[model samples]
Target: MSLRRRMCTVAAGAAAAPFVLVMLPAGVANAHGYVSDPPSRQAQCADGTVECGPIQWEPQSVEGPKGLDMCSGGNARFAELDNDHHGWEVTDVASTVEFSWTKTAAHSTRDWQYFIDGDLVAEFDGGNEQPPFSVDHTVDLSDYSGEHTVLAVWNIADTANAFYACTDVNIT
Candidate 1:
């Protein structure tokens, strides 16, 4: 190509660089949601309440296959969440705890499941519809007491993936 043509090409590329950079994140917005209230492990990390790894940067991205029973959702990048002795803050609560979730990229949901000690405590129907930006579920924990880890799962309706978060709590 001629020198003039090369210069024109470079100028055009430079002009579009900013726009390209801005739109780059649009394609990586697949990150969905995570528990924010009662502060799930990922939530604590994201908010700096607890020191964690990459999960601190993208808490809403702890997504993996549905029916998972772990906090990190089987995502190796967030494996720190699976560590139970990582000085995670335990929220003190009564027999009932209302867990709240923040959805960054709201997708259709199949259901929301809460488990403790690997036992299902509550399950809410999502009706295969998109949820609100913030979702809340008042779970009854009257059957159990003392320190416990609550695993909350947001099962996406259309996909086989689910978002997972573990909340440490002292039930009084």
Candidate 2:
């Protein structure tokens, strides 16, 4: 090939490289799940609703060993989500509130649990199929009024790990 032709081809390839890359899958590049509704603390940090650090970059990555109530999925980098004094946003909700989880990557979910003041208030069987992009559950909060913190747990169906999220809410 001629020198000029080779240079032109190389430049053209370089110019189109980014566009090509965009079409391919990111391949497990980020968090598999995060609560987007009522905005989990990590999600709030991710969207700039609250000022934060590294957790803001990967909100759905707070995964840890199963059967635990600690928030941030046992990941210390996102421990800020467990701190209510971090100036987090409080979502105003009704007697019945909807909890939503946004899945970046689908997985076979075992169960979904919601806790208030360290007590399990609601639990949903995940079933056998892989969860969808947006999974939601209507939780009755009649027993809970005023400011409360909800710790949500997403247990993996086929693994020993689970994802965790926390949201502060004001029920009126």
Candidate 3:
């Protein structure tokens, strides 16, 4: 082609590149699931119950390496979840609390685990099968009281990653 035509085409493509990038999704490209009920940190952000950064937009995208104990699944972009004093709303609950997950993208699961103060409180085996749109676990928190953080981990059966969520609760 002509030199002028080639230069014009190159410039046009360069001008459009930025727009294309902006139109694309950001944050975790594979955002999958997060605790919804009792409103985990991300859930609160998604529901506007609390102010957050990028996590506010993609609450279900808190995936990270397996065996992570903190919320945000070890993702720095979502470090806000690791902030214990981030003004996360504390839900009042009974001794028996049901933690639920809202899976935006279902994937084969290994098992679900719940921890309170670094102690394993409850767990459910997934049998290497994909979970439903929502999964619930009835955890007996009668042994603990007052405000506490519950870290829930969803270990995927197919991937070397897990989704993490932290819900603050004041058990009555």
Which numbered prediction scores highest in TM-score against the true structure? 1
Q: Rank the candidates by lDDT, best first.
A: 1, 3, 2
Where is the poorest 10-residue window by lDDT in model 3?
Answer: 24-33
Cα error, candidate 3, residue 12 (Å): 33
Q: Which pairs of residues have clashing backbones in candidate 3?
A: none
Query: On residues 12-116, what C-alpha lDDT tens digit does candidate 3 reach at each position?
Result: 999999999999875433439999998999999998999999999999999999988989899999999999999999999999999999988788889999999
The C-alpha stretches of model 3 lying farther than 4 A from their native spots are 1-31
Better of 1 and 2 by TM-score: 1
lDDT of each: 0.92, 0.87, 0.91
For candidate 1, write residues 105-135 as lDDT tens digits.
8888899999999999999999988788899
- Over 4 Å off in model 2, which ranges? 1-31
Worst 10 residues of 2 by lDDT: 25-34
Model 3 CA lDDT for position 46? 92
TM per candidate comes to 0.83, 0.81, 0.81
RMSD of 1: 4.5
Q: How does model 1 fare in lDDT?
A: 0.92
